[model samples]
Target: MTRFRLRSGVVGVALLALAASSCASDKAGDGGAGTGADGVKHGPGVTDDTITLGLITDLTGPYAPIGKSLSQAAQLYYDEINLGGGICGRQVETLVRDMSYDAQKTAVAYTELEPKVAALPQFLGSTTIASVRDRLEASGPLTLALAWAPSVLGAKPIQMTGTTYAIDVINGVDHLVKDRGLKKGDKIGHVYLEGDYGDDSVAGSKYAADKLGLSVVEQKVKPTDADMSSQVSALKQAGVKAIILSIAPKQTASFVGVAATAGLKVPVLGSNSAFAPQLLATDAGPAFLGDFAVLQAASPLSADLPIMKTIIAGYSDKFPKDGLDNGVMAGYTSAMVVGDALKKACENKDLSRDGIIAAHRSQNAWDGGFGSTMDFTDPAQPPTRKTYLLKPDPKAAGGLTVQKDNFTSDLAAAYPVTAG
Candidate 1:
């Protein structure tokens, strides 16, 4: 509102703004906004002082702990940004929903959140994301993919953090050979759920085995089916020297527990989704004391790297009493990537969903403080071939020791973009 004092001989001036239709039509999705005749632009979830984003995670399901930790970590960054006046001077606010790691429920949640938020920064479950993608594409929100399924490459608004699960597998297998002195022809065991996530990991392992002239014994388990005893039995009977697991935390717990009961003692390598902080307290915790290793693309908290240090300091300062682990640290890093995109979107004052997507296109080998380089220009291509190696360290940040930081293998070149 404007107030003015005018004398009888003086004239009062009225200010008016003109809407630029060309610019209005030039923003991001059906989620685009209307430009007022007065030149005030209002996009979905973007207001004078607030920009709303959505977060859909597995709050109450098997990945609940992960979701909770991730959300907390994201909030830490978002809150820090907010304290600094946020992006474009609008406070960043994320509306979170728990889909319980279910695709149908995620679809419902996405539909509910689509009309109200500019983008989604946290979406867990690769297969679940795949199941509900039609719903997502219909109302395109820039989504940060927690699941690294190769099928996600080139999918609009879905930026994958790490390489595909298959590639992660390739790196892990090669690591075993070089670091663990795993010889060619050594029988390796694979225990994974029956889904895209599992398939991607298995593909990498199989590809690496073929290249190295080794053999693999696979034990497929359904996510819904809890019994891993049979799978353990099969691998044990095969005289597998080591095992790789590409499953969730609950499934991981079962794998470790069931293996011990079956007297199958071997080093277990896990994919990113395979480890959780709470797993250390489970009955199988003892078995994983030092026997379990999780392969990831992000730097572990134990690293002296700037990104890890920032996450640790910020997280500890923000939520001191809560434990810091991989799940939460991963969440923090994901938020950092999203924050970078948002900052870019703020330019030109067009914060529409489409504008955010465009911001990604300009990204080339973006560090995002995680050390992995990401190229969003060709979203379909693999972003990075690097992997971070971490072993369980309860006393360390994220409960893992950083054995390697963004390390690549000679066999990494052999990994293909098979996820697409």
Candidate 2:
């Protein structure tokens, strides 16, 4: 496992105080420490009554459904918190922007939000976030990324709410070998987008294949390439036992629908972002119900877990027109983490960005009423290796059912995820 080092607590606290003091303007304001009249220390995006966070997401691209889901669920959580007196006597507000899954737009969004928000809890894509990672490392807010690529874990302030894409693939492949009757020397097909998400997932598949004596036949595609007839044909000719997907919902639907029509009946598995609840209303819906599963870090909104019951009821009531999906669970959980960190910072009386980061790093065994507890002490490693394997279901809430809850195969647990 790879690890990134943060500054020592004492040094960080002092430096943060100095930076806040040096940057503090003489004029009264709400975004900087000592800028307000209350005498309580605050940071950018913070005031006497509100703490503003940024939500940079894709609302017009392939990931729009997920972005919407995340935004809505997070808002619901924040509303609940505000109703209950909020964190540190302040209401949480979000400065939202639609980056459309574009890196350039993300850069612009970051520039616009960086000076006004205290933190970011929903920066949506690996590629988009990577575009601005350098700036983030230099002076970015405490960010909770919606992406799962291992590379995102390198930044000090950026944290993922769940396991990486690589671990998800490792667990998915392990299930294929142990439970799906795949044997040594078998061929497993991988169709992925050509970026951090795909590359990391392929890395996991290769590692698991090497351990299980299986061969990986890879097919890389661009996000714009929606038709999967050729890729499906190639994998069919390769005679692969199963296929792993690390693309978006459009690609997954096309691949599965094409494969089904091509007479290739193999187990199809996907990363968390590969499927959306809206897909169940499409022509590919039937194919998704057959031999297709997804790996998720959080439980579905329909999960039997107690917290899920509250989330589902609240979400249905809050967003009547929107459909429930895994993004709802993911967004709510990420907000929960952010709220916890803010509360800790309040207790320390240092709600500055540095204080928030420090508070987040101290969490070692935190549970958000999810199935698994996470350890956030190590920013380099995923908080947990346990993942849920889910299957699409037309009748289920979130349009999916959990096949394996909080499962971690031996291979996944043993794999060493390193920095690039």
- Cα-based RMSD of candidate 2: 9.4
Model 2: lDDT to the true structure = 0.82
The alpha-carbon deviation from the true structure for residue 297 of candidate 1, after best TM-score superposition, in angstroms, is: 1.3
lDDT of 2 by residue, 1-420 (tens): 001112346434532333233222322224776534555568888888788887888766556656767877888898899899978887777766778788888899888788888888878877898899999888888888888888788777888888989999999999998889999989999999898889999999999999999999999999789899999999999999999999878788899999999999999998878887777778888999899999987877778888998999898898786667777888899888888989888888888888888889899998988877898888788888888899888788878888988788888888787742
Per-residue lDDT tens digits of candidate 1, residues 1-420?
Answer: 001111312211110011111111212223338652334354676766667777778766656655666877888889889888888777787777777778788888887777778778888877678877766665677888887888777666788887877887888888888878789779999888778889888988998999987899988878687767788888888998888999877778888888887778788898877877567766777767757788887777787778788888888887675677666777887888888887887764567777777787688879876667877777676778788777776567666777766677778765668534
Shift in Å, residue 322, candidate 1? 2.9
* Candidate 1 worst ten-residue window by lDDT: 14-23
Alpha-carbon TM-score of each model against the true structure: 0.85, 0.89
- In terms of lDDT, model 1 sits at 0.74
Worst 10 residues of 2 by lDDT: 19-28
Find the candidate with the highest lDDT and give its number. 2
True lDDT of residue 403, candidate 1:
70
